[model samples]
Target chain A: MSFHLGGDKRASLAEAAARVGDGALVALGGGLCARLPMALVREMVRQGRRDLHLVGSAHSIDVDLLIAAGAVGVCEESYVGFEQDLGLAPAFRRAARDGSVEVRESCCATVLAQLRAAEAGVPFLPVRGIKGTDVEGLHPEYARMTCPFTGEELVVVPPLRPDVALLHAPLGDAHGNLHLDQPFVLDERFAHASVAVVATVDRIVPTAELVGAGVVVPGHLVAAVAEVPYGAHPSSCYPGYAYDRPHLAAYLAAATAGGTALDEYLARYVHVDEDTYAKDVDPERLAAWSGSTRAWQELFR
Target chain B: MSWALDAGHAAQRSWTLDEAFVVALARTIRDTEAVFHGFASPCAQVAMHVAKRTHAPDCLLIEGATYAVDPVPVFVPPTGNDLALHRDAVYRMRFEEFFDAACRGAVDRMFLSGGQIDGYGSTNVTAIGGMPHPKIKLGGGGGGGNISASIGALTVWTSRHRAGRTLVADLDFLTDLGHRTREGSRAELGYTGGGPQWLVTELGAFDFDGDGHARLRALWPDVDVDDVAAATGFELRVALDGADGLLDPPSPAELAAVRAVDPLGVRRSEFAEVELARTPGLSGVAR
Candidate 1:
């Protein structure tokens, strides 16, 4: 596939989210509740695009916000929940409970298998194990095949090529080369499997200065790179900041209260611009959390 | 590299339910084993790191961060699973590679938890009460649901277990299907190995006995037999000879070790932890 930036790759978060267009199957990076593209996610909600499909193996805040905003129409994920630490996600829980959302619950393997198939440009990926589990019957539209070599039944997942891949990285260049200190965690696969990828980073550095550290998402696959500092706030960006626990706690508190409380939170946080949204949080605490984390994360150097 | 600090303050505090749970979970980890922590697993992450630093120094610890640093740091994320938790790990592994290891049975043990757990070791991390659409929809089978069917053993860390919420007569959904894929079908699906080798809860610890039913192996010090039995909806199998086998409380050394990695009290956050502990540092790396 030929890679094109449509022009200059450096764009705003709004511009990157706008490039995704409407009704696109979006793939979010990060596992559980880390490294999510919260800036872009909030932008999608701010723009009010409905009838969208989400594809990712593990998700937390990114999926929850999308579900709460009533923007996601379908989701193909391993599972969507705040880890044991944060309890259950309220907006997503309520939406799924009411049947307004269509969720395809999978073991993490199936989701990875689908992404691998898409990255390989294949129709299906044959995976071992999970043939006898509920993964068999979850998606009737999907099928299971017999492995030709061993004649053993294998779970075959359909290719899940996303229209756009949105993720947050620790560092990136103006040309869209991303440097993430952490493991790929399915972000590289998403970049390969998606038609276009939008990355939000802590900073856009000079390409010449991005030495020693390897580029995780190559510039060619990236459609745009937005230098949005604290882009993954409320979520952690390795080598940069940690998740805002107090902020997440407040959001959870509001979400659990249900109804108007969630709306009030979105109005103050998600609906506002990056600057105003960030102001809602104490700048000192955010700096300290990220500051304490830098030494441990930067040991890669 | 950041220098190690004194872990003195954290040691003096009493071990809470979450801390005891961490020690119990850590004991299950054997040396020279490969372990993985799945989604939303804070308690499990702490246990793996604790064991890696102490008893099982050679154990292969894997998580999303793909961290591979020598002499791991006490990198704790305030929220859920983060790469920082895997700080000082000496290798970078992708999810696909981990999946390959799982399918090949290269993994020895893993940590798992769900919205619901039954007496037979089947867990429901998916929806509750109904299907397609349900009364409650929690996060569905992360890696655990598949790990139950693929991995060799599971160490479930459940912080809270109420009658209707967790311990139940029947699971609302079977996200993780171990040897007991169905209630009566034990490893009939060709998947072998005992399921839920160590099932640790807030009240006690359990293991699947010979007949594939949950056997109560140990209980927390504070709780009595009635307290545990009443909290459970199903008939629990207690260890014979009247020895409740109370879990060994976290030694000062264990607390110091826990404080080293978790100086911020992330573990304590499960039940309202404080940032700065004033107590003596029973830990090795004093605060």
Candidate 2:
């Protein structure tokens, strides 16, 4: 009942996102400074889904890219990475200037409200804790009547119920149970808030082997599973892996340098195909490039 | 060169003239103090002023807006999001990937303020009027005030007018439930940090008692207990000995420090004026 699939197999990222429907709330999972599914997100952007609502805590290159491409209509709460990480993507800046996106504070609250709403089987949940601040005006939906006892004004936030949650896990089983050793704040909530959840993992192991591996989002919440090796590249999976800083630096350079520069760069490298991009860059060479002065300087330039 | 605390004539003084409060606030988080600040907060501006001037020359000021620490130059990208300042510093990754460090308690301290906080320290930043059907609609509360109560030590402050805005009793919406009503529930839920430690306001200071009620800790000099009582929408228990009242006014030395740090008088003057306009009666103080 929790799973649904479109007819296409090996569909593009845009096709996957299309299945989510319009005005759908989407939740993303990754590291504070990890790589996100940008290639997939690019596919979503190419599809030009304007009715999508994005909610997340921290900023990622993928989110930045989406916002740049005009894919996100509303952002509940999120932070933008430093410009160097952003590459040449100016979409976030343009959106803020145009008042297309409303930035609020606190990712946990946004995720939690959705989780509570889903758990309570309600359309939205009322929350407190932000009052007499600018956040009240930014998120007008949360402000409420003065307390009967206290006579003070309150801000109420509605719960977030996403139609689909797209997450990447380090390991999983065929049945979709996930194993993420990292300590995350809102992944559990994202799992609960979604009508269906899709998880992409690096490896597929037996369900019995995951018995004591410290599961964050349980298997039941996960709808479908896909196995993709080194899926969390750019974004580290913690104990299992680390971020590919060189590839990320190169990506940052191309993304932040301007659209023309990005096009030229991606054409020479990333855009041809995932396999071509993967084969073109030598892992050993990337590994040899230390996350040092040269790397940072190159990224900015 | 001299520090003088004058209780009787405190209100007559300007932020430029009064230095004690600035000095105390600055000195509090000088060395190795992991302080957290909220967005668009004037108090945070003052804290930054203090931190840069007094103590930790290399202080790690972690901003919610951005993650690049010191040595990272502050560049205000055109977007107005301070996080953009560090965008160049962020490595590419999936979104929501950063919570690993945050959940493991990488953050040390946080600054927070609330609307309609109750006796239980529960804050509501939700809708006003009513739940399903409300007379007045409000912006959705963000973050649910969880970060404020979850951090190691939370310094809560507000600059709102006391009369019609503040709460006298329990809140209509619950943003953050400060100290849980029952003792065992918090630990049972896997949260290990203490609740809010301090509540500060333009009028006075408050702290939660062992029994889980806010107790008045201090009042601003030149502010009468009646003024505070009238301004507060709720009935509050005053200190028995009146020891919590402002006895020693803010000293000139403190004022000098504030002036020296904020040479343009940004925190005390224009900023205060902007905040005062939002809350009535404070306009006189601003002028």
Candidate 3:
């Protein structure tokens, strides 16, 4: 692991995206459709980062968009579909099938175990299950040993140290102290385990305000931070805004249509400036979602 | 896919096929147990809600995405991660803490499904064909591999089991621990939890026998033994008592509980288009 003790760790979205080099192993910080760091992801796409290896527990558009942009070559995630909402991720499915991407399938428990091992500075950690299933055979890094105390056989996974972790949050300080929201899927673990963390936040507050809000990630653990409002546009940064269902539907339509349609979508959204993308997504309308319970419910309708 | 508008609680005559199937799913839950449902499982989510509102009120319900414990959401949202699902949650579980509890055999039951579920109870959510490149890359099993080894029981369901490629004779890849697998039996593998207890499908329900194979236990209305046998890829095994295996239709109370818990009819999305057309009030609902 690495530490950033600098007094100010803030950077532009492009600079934060540059912190993740080409062919680097990236730890995606959120799960499903919430706080997925999409602004930074779009910037990375525009910069043409290539051969990224993505590691996560569960994800959707963030990972799919990278693959669709031809930036990802290896996927180590346990799950990559859109859950019950939109069904499977079309680009990921196609890439995995056509042999464009390597699928090192993992489970949530093993991924957590690997990250915990890295966090503890251990070489490996034993996981409770995964034996007798084909998943065990797929991971050559996994080994079997007898428990010294109980003489029971167990599977142990090696520690995974990603090159950089991408995270999005509701609040963070210029120094990199972050107040992550709940359902903190694997963001805390990813922050602690990765070598460096590059993040985007809806707003960057003072260190005092951040500490008052309860800091989940301390300043020293983060490499860089970019204050980009509505950073997780298509995805939800809860208490800030709900996921843009219509935008996601349009994206799915374009991606499902084929390469040309997807490229046109990228040209219209990804290659644009942050302010333009925000305006196109209608920030005022998205901000109004949290005005009331009824408004929030109507967002999904 | 737009869900049919709720229409603000229109009158209905009979329960739809999805409601009947959800009641069958709820029957598998014990009154006192810790049950977990994963994301993308609308039927299981509705079943858990129905069971809690009706029979299994004390069951420790866990939301898949939010990880909230004992949440009393007004209705199940289309997406699992919304704060709507976390409304009135007694406690929110962290990702690591819940898995740690499952490793200690704390989770009593979990809901699981697959692209292919074999007679031995093994499931394949990993892929459809060979490894290096699969014919179809299914959504990989999120935590089923470890949870299946530690949880007390598993309730397997598949809506596409009606002559679809669901109940296969062999799985291309075994993604979860079952009664027995390519490596060995669960006892040999030292699995702490009992494997799949029931396999509920659109056609019928199955219970594992002493030999650890799926045996027919109940049939849905209008589904005969021949129909199930024709759809099944493996040789069918029936319970010792033949005619008694027919599943009883959902009672009025059970139907009312399902409707109350799922006012938006979110569970109807689990069915195919042909099946959705069979729904009572929301007939011809397009997905």
Candidate 4:
């Protein structure tokens, strides 16, 4: 069967984390500043699930928070600034000092390669271009083999078939067809590579209306769907709505501050419910702040 | 010449006679041997073109962006430094491994330019106000001016209106320091490579003096030193015997090669029409 009706769309992020299994390759949607499911990600960390392998592009604030909380076991790429979203020098420095995170090269490509391998039904794909750099030694799971003809070392990237994939979309129908104009990086690929795909949409429309609207993700790949209004909020859908810059700014300040500063910051901002946090944060406050607000602000603003 | 012919065929309709100038400059620099190009630089394109065509067919083209030698043309969609292409190369590397390469003397020649370069070959690509927080935030200088000053040799290029942008006084920010301020400082800092060698501009080229300061070396034919002096915002001291050489108008082949790599003419786009009109002679050279 292509459909399952085990969960409610209005369920909390913590409840969603319960659905994810151990060692499952999870692809989180959203860009460096887009509407990411940070609430679910935080719950995953609080639950202390080490078996899950996380991957994404740029640095998602949610990802950094999880890593900071000691919930993440391995990260393939570096975490950018909490404000500027440029270099993750500070985060990497802290991670190095703590010796908790394993910094790998090409987080996006490595994850993409795994998805590609799985989609192709191949055990491994021979990838060129990553031979000599630091990425090779970081992920021992992928071996480096030499080409007999050219004598060049090629990375043998193993297939990534995620047990479950979690994604957020702008809208969907009860039948589970997703629709989104933005957040189009590797969402489709992640869906195809996973055994089950769980998508959260902003609102649910009639299947006929969605089909006629030409915004669809073909019900075949999607296993379940949930309608969560204003879901993308602070993470933004781009062109649909601007990011909640003030909330992002506060998160960045707390994130980079470290020690009790980070803890207090997360408690006041991140840990709270979406409604309460939204009401508390005045989006217009970002307009008043001059200069580069923080790394995260650069992602959207 | 044979490589040029091959490149011509590869570029097809995009190849024009103007490319020869870039090709020639590349050849000139390649002949010098052991030249380095900075990240996301047009000079890198010229250097690579010259290396592939002439002296160093087998020369190691080191890149800060990516390590891979793309088989496709240099100007292709992804270009050379797309992280997707090079991610696997440095996979799993600790920060120390990358720093080791920079700390060591493995890097040779480098290319850099300052927002305001003074009589001394010093450049400032940093913020003008202050550190920790500046009133205006200029992007961080990649490796400070250390790469230019410490590398075996350095090449500096500026396309800005000389008089307005190029200056007389020291810069507000020290983007890249040409050389160590004090004697014996090089050894103290563990730097052993050579310092700034050539400063190329639309007007012509300049080089450092014995004390490692800028001295006008050569001017293009049909251009007078007075015009150059007028164009410069700073007081430029020309060498007593400074001579004028036909700044070989870029050969058709050289211009074609440069245009092929940069179709939009990112270099020329930086200049204003008023500036271009003021320097009619330089305009012809740019075209």
| Model 2 alpha-carbon drift over 4 Å, by segment | A1-18, A35-39, A46-50, A83-89, A99-107, A123-126, A147-152, A245-253, A265-272, A280-301, B1-287
Q: In CAPRI terms, where does candidate 4 land?
A: incorrect
Interface RMSD of each: 4.3, 11.2, 1.3, 13.7
Report how closely model 1 matches the true complex, as a DockQ value.
Answer: 0.39
RMSD of each: 6.3, 12.7, 4.7, 14.7
The residue-by-residue lDDT of candidate 1 on B129-175, one tens digit each, is 84677788877776655556667787865665634367766776777
lDDT of 3 at B24: 83
What does chain B score (TM) in every candidate? 0.82, 0.67, 0.89, 0.69
What stretches of model 3 exceed 4 Å from their correct place? A287-294, B1-13, B240-247, B279-287
Alpha carbon lDDT of residue B86, candidate 4?
28
Instruction: Name the docking class for model 2.
Output: incorrect
User: Each prediction's Cα lDDT score?
Assistant: 0.71, 0.50, 0.85, 0.51
Query: How far does residue A127 in candidate 4 sit from its true spot (Å)?
Result: 1.4
Worst 10 residues of 1 chain A by lDDT: A292-301
Model number with the top lDDT: 3
Highest TM-score, which number?
3
DockQ score, prediction 2: 0.06
lDDT per residue for candidate 3 within A120-197, as digits (tens), equals 999999998898888887789899999999999999999999999899989999999988877999999999999999
- Per-candidate clashes come to 19, 74, 0, 44
